[model samples]
Target: MAGIKALISLSFGGAVGLMFLMLGCALPVYDEYWPLFVLFFYVLSPIPYCVSRRVTDDTDATSNACKELAVFLTTGIVVSAFGLPVIFARVHVIAWGACALVVTGNIVIFATILGFFLVFGSSDDFSWQQW
Candidate 1:
């Protein structure tokens, strides 16, 4: 159960991380001069993540599951929310493509990290482990 939860959390985290990374790439491609708005989204991108972390407690199964679900839903909303900004910001297609690539890269990285954590975090006997 713990291993499964870790895997799920890792998957979600990776996906959200990728979304933010892509969103970052998109911010630069827009012709509109709203650096602040871009900055706002850039900053807001991590809000849910931070919140989710606070909500999640790996040691507690029930709470962890709840937090995971909350984080997953929140992440989806946050990702979709960016669409409005992209439209309003008047982002170019090329920039959008760049964002996609960045997002892809982030997702890959997130997955890797998540897998690492899943394995490391699952080991019951941490006494044998070394960072």
Candidate 2:
């Protein structure tokens, strides 16, 4: 089914992104765990949106304050995820190569997250809530 296929691809993408994050932290040439802090950002990024979705009703209006605030918070979390690695690299806590790897991982992971919302954030038969 199309839903199954989308789930598989999204899972694969998330795995690949985590692999890159692990490499950035565990590679012998760049064995620094500072980049691991980005995992916190990853965990926090979706919370705002999920909370807002639960708290607000879907409306036909052009805009909604709760949803806008949720998006703002999500953007801050994502920016923090990207910025943390750069700060670590700048402070020499992690190598530039490691920062680059972490950034790439962030990109892939965020894209996968976005893809998930796009594919599942609908009032259709294939809603992710069923899982």
Candidate 3:
């Protein structure tokens, strides 16, 4: 099914992203675990949106305060995720090369998250809730 295929692709993307993250942190040249803090951002990024969705009612208003706040919080989390590596690099806690790799990983992981929502957040027959 399409949903199954989408799930598989998303999983692959997440795995690839995490691979990049791990490479940045665990590579002999970098050898710094400071970049691992971005994993917290990755975990926190979706919480606001999920919470808001659960607390608010779906309506045709085209805009909702709860959703907007959630988006804002999500944006902050994403920005924080991207910024942490740069901060680490600036402080010499990690190498610039590692920062670049971590940033790349963040991009891939966030894109995969967006793709998951786009694919499974629909009101169609194949909602992610089914899984």
Order of quality (lDDT): 3, 2, 1
Name the lDDT value of residue 86 in candidate 1.
Answer: 53
| lDDT agreement with native, every candidate | 0.51, 0.92, 0.93
TM value for model 1: 0.36
Off by over 4 Å in 3: none
Residue 8 CA displacement from its true place in model 3, Å: 0.7
- How many clashes (backbone N, Cα, C below 3 Å) per candidate? 0, 0, 0
lDDT measured at residue 98 in model 1 versus the true structure, 0 to 100: 47
Cα displacement (Å) at residue 127, model 1: 8.5
Candidate 2 residues lying further than 4 Å off, grouped into runs, are none
RMSD of each: 8.5, 0.9, 1.0
Q: Report lDDT (Cα) of residue 52, candidate 1.
A: 61
Worst 10 residues of 2 by lDDT: 53-62
